[model samples]
Target: MTESPSVITKRADFLAANRGLRVARPGFVLLAQPNDGKGKRYGITVTKKIGNAVVRNRMKRRFRELLRAQLPVRGLPDHDHVLIGRDGGIERAFARLAEELDDALARAAAGKGDPRRRRPARGNRR
Candidate 1:
C-alpha cells in the first residue's frame, strides 16, 4: 500500500528542514531534507508579509492542494518538504505554480538545489 505524505506541525521540524536542500521558484521555495527513514512529511508556511489573513490563508490553501496532489508520488521519500510562500505566489496562476513545483521537485531529486542564501547582518533591535 502507498502511504500518503504526513503533515509537519512542529517548529523544530521546520527549522531542521531549513538546513536541507532549497529550490526557489518565482512563486515559492521548496525545502527538502531526509528525515532519517521517516515517512514523507510536509509543511506550508505563509507569512503575514505575504498579505492579510485572508490572503495568507488563501495561499496556504492553494499550497496545501498542490502538495497533496504532487508530494505523495513525486516528493523525495523519507524527506521533509516545506513550502515557503512568496508575494508573487498569491498572484500567480495555479497551473503555473504547479509546473514550477514539478520542476523544483525534479531539481531536488537530482540534488541540483540552488545555492544557499546569505543572511543579512542583524543590527541591534529595540
Candidate 2:
C-alpha cells in the first residue's frame, strides 16, 4: 500500500517522538526512526553539507523512490521515518542507497522496537 501525503507526520511530531535508527558507514550515516501512527510515512533531511539545492533535491528524490520500493513489501505502518543525507550524497549511487534502505528495513523488522509492532487490538483484552 502506498502512503498518502496527507497522512505524513509533520516535522514537529517526528522530532519529538522518533528515537532514531542509525546505520553508519565511512562515507555516510543513515538515520531512521519510527513514527507513532498507522502506515509508513517518510521524510528527507539533507543539510548544506550534502550540497546546494540541486544536490539536496536530487538526494531527496532518490531516497523517496528507493524507500517507496523498499518499504511497503515489509508491511511497515503508521511510522514517520526520516533519512538524513550526508556529505557527498550527490555522488552516492542510486542502487547503493536502495540497498542500504532494504538492509535497514530488515534490521528494523528484526528488532522488537519496530513500529510495525502495533496493530490495533482486534478484541477486548479483558
Candidate 3:
C-alpha cells in the first residue's frame, strides 16, 4: 500500500531544506534535500506577500493537494520537499502546477537544479 507522504513541521527542517536543490517555476519554488533516510516528507509555505490570511490559506490548501497527489510516487525518496508559494501560484491552474512540479522533480532527480538565489543585503539599522 502506498503511504501518504509525511508532513514537515519543524522550523529546522524547513531551514535545512532551503540548502538543498532548488527548482523555480512561475508558480512556486521546489526545494528538495536528503533527510538521512527519514522517508518521503514534505512541507508547504505561503507567505503573507502572496495575500491576506484567506488567500494564503487557500494557496496552502492547493499546494497540500498537489503534494499529496504527486509526492508519494513522483517525489524523490528519502528527501524532504518544501514548496514556497509564489504570487502567480495562487491563480495558476492546478494541472499546470502539477506539470511544473513533475518537470521540477525530473530536473532535481537528474541533479540539474537551479543556482541558489542570493539574498539581498539588509539596509543598516539606525
- Report the lDDT tens digits of candidate 2 across residue range 1-126: 554432344767557434665555322454455655545666667788777788888877887777667666743565555666777666778777667667766665665333423556779544
Off by over 4 Å in 1: 124-126
The residue pairs found clashing in candidate 2 are 35-80, 37-78, 38-78, 39-77, 39-78
Please report, in order, the local distance difference test score of every candidate based on alpha carbons. Answer: 0.95, 0.61, 0.93
**Tens-place lDDT digits, model 1, residues 21-125:** 999999999999999988899999999889899999999999999999999889999999999999899999999999999999999999999999876667743
Q: List the residue pairs that clash in candidate 1.
A: none
Worst 10 residues of 1 by lDDT: 117-126
Q: Which scores greater on lDDT, model 2 or model 3?
A: 3
Model 2 lDDT at residue 100: 63
Give the clash total for candidate 1.
0
Which of 1 and 2 is ahead in lDDT? 1
Count steric clashes of candidate 3: 0
Overlapping backbone residue pairs in candidate 2 total 5
